[model samples]
Target: MKALLTKLAFPILNALEKSEGSYEYSPSHRTILKVMGFLFMVISAVGLYFSMKIEQWAGLFPVILFAGIGILCWIVAFLGSDKAVSKLWRNRNE
Candidate 1:
């Protein structure tokens, strides 16, 4: 189960890791997460609106998935951004 989850999350984790390297300076992980969460929420809202307008239930899947991921990001930001940032820095310095 853990391995399955890790496999599922690998893409997100890799993206976050790569983002750290792409920046010339380290970013505040909390801020980054918050901004990303906000953007995702906006996308979710738009997607949902369009789906409803079209009356297609299938469109809700992606919107719900993005919303769930966005909420998870926000939770991580609030609970562990410091730890995450430290890990990123440590990895970069190694």
Candidate 2:
């Protein structure tokens, strides 16, 4: 299943998994990333609900934005390698 998911999100994974230098990583980074993803997903859901309730198409922008970000977070948090997670977190000390 993981292999299949990794294949499906190859584009995103490929970009982050490429390592050029040393990076700092911690287990908590992945946990925090997953939490952030879940929060973003919740925000997206709320935006979608409000958009429908208000009949305002403009709200779809945020909905899409949050959803895309959330999905990216989830994909990286789960399917991506440690290097990818480190990349996503970026080289803080650099």
- Name the top TM-score candidate: 2
Clashes of 1: 0
Per-residue CA lDDT of model 2 for 2-37, tens digit only, reads: 889989999889989776777888989899899999
Q: What's the lDDT of the predicted structure labeled candidate 1?
A: 0.66
How does residue 51 of candidate 1 score in lDDT? Answer: 99
What are the Cα lDDT values of the candidates?
A: 0.66, 0.90
lDDT of 1 by residue, 5-77 (tens): 5466666555555544322224565677778888998999999999999999999999999998787676546
Backbone clash numbers for all candidates listed: 0, 0
Error of 1 at 10 (Å): 20
C-alpha lDDT of residue 36 in model 2:
95
Model 1 residue pairs with clashes:
none
Name every residue pair that clashes in candidate 2.
none
